[model samples]
Target: MPSYDSWPSPTWKKIIEEQLEQVEQMPRADFDIMLKKQLPMAVYNKELMTGDTLDAYLEPHAGSLGKASFFSHQVAHYNAKYTESYGTDLPKLKVPVQILWGEEDEWQPLMYAKRLVQDIPHACLHVIPKAGHFVMEDEPGQCSDYIDRFCNKHP
Candidate 1:
């Protein structure tokens, strides 16, 4: 179970609320622009967060306001159960767990990775450098290598 002391920052809450409120009134292009501006926070490499990349990332999400609404609804209700815990269940996971985490993740702190490693009996963590929340985007080669190695080892 992930810690939720300050999981969703005020900025994320505000963004979700803004998306929910303005989805109908705002132009789709304008909403995309507004959302694209916030996308860089997920990536450590600012240079990789180009206009084309942002557009591509947003394309899949563009057709579904319902998806956005569902996420917003979840976020709205998250606070009510933030403190819920499943400490006893984590150790019961018998499968091998490989946690590929970003070293510079701004959203999820490194402590979560440490906590998970401690909780899961057959778990290992690999903190990829020069990566943020979107570790694969930030360091695709490293992410691919780690995932391939994990899969091969487990299989």
Candidate 2:
């Protein structure tokens, strides 16, 4: 029964350590540098500021948002739905589709890219280095390049 914030903290660490007997892995220095470079562009400053202010406003009235639930539910639902929808016969899309995925994405592994290319008739796959699930956010330039290439080829 760990809360969202606490799940990533001491309780989860102890459980993981006990069950998996795994040591915490520190981020590589280059990864930190890449994160610093990417975070600004990833965050919509105005939206972030607005969301923060709204959170502060709502903090005083905790009951306003209604019943609290496991934060992971939404993510689980989306993942399940995505898998279900894509499991069917692939769409007959004529437009050129580019599947850009991060090599380091834990949520959707690079194998998904290959599966996508196989499923989609005109799909091309691009794997971005040193990126995670949020590939567009992590590698904006690479994402833009993929889009540009797709457009050029399609046109």
Q: List the residue pairs that clash in candidate 2.
A: none
lDDT of 2: 0.50
Question: Candidate 2: where are CA atoms >4 Å away?
Answer: 1-76, 79-82
- CA lDDT of each prediction against the hidden true structure: 0.72, 0.50
Superposed Cα deviation of residue 92, candidate 1 (Å)? 1.5
Kindly provide the TM-score of model 2 when superposed on the true structure, using C-alpha atoms. Answer: 0.50
For every model shown, what is its TM-score relative to the native structure?
Answer: 0.77, 0.50
lDDT of 2 at 102: 75
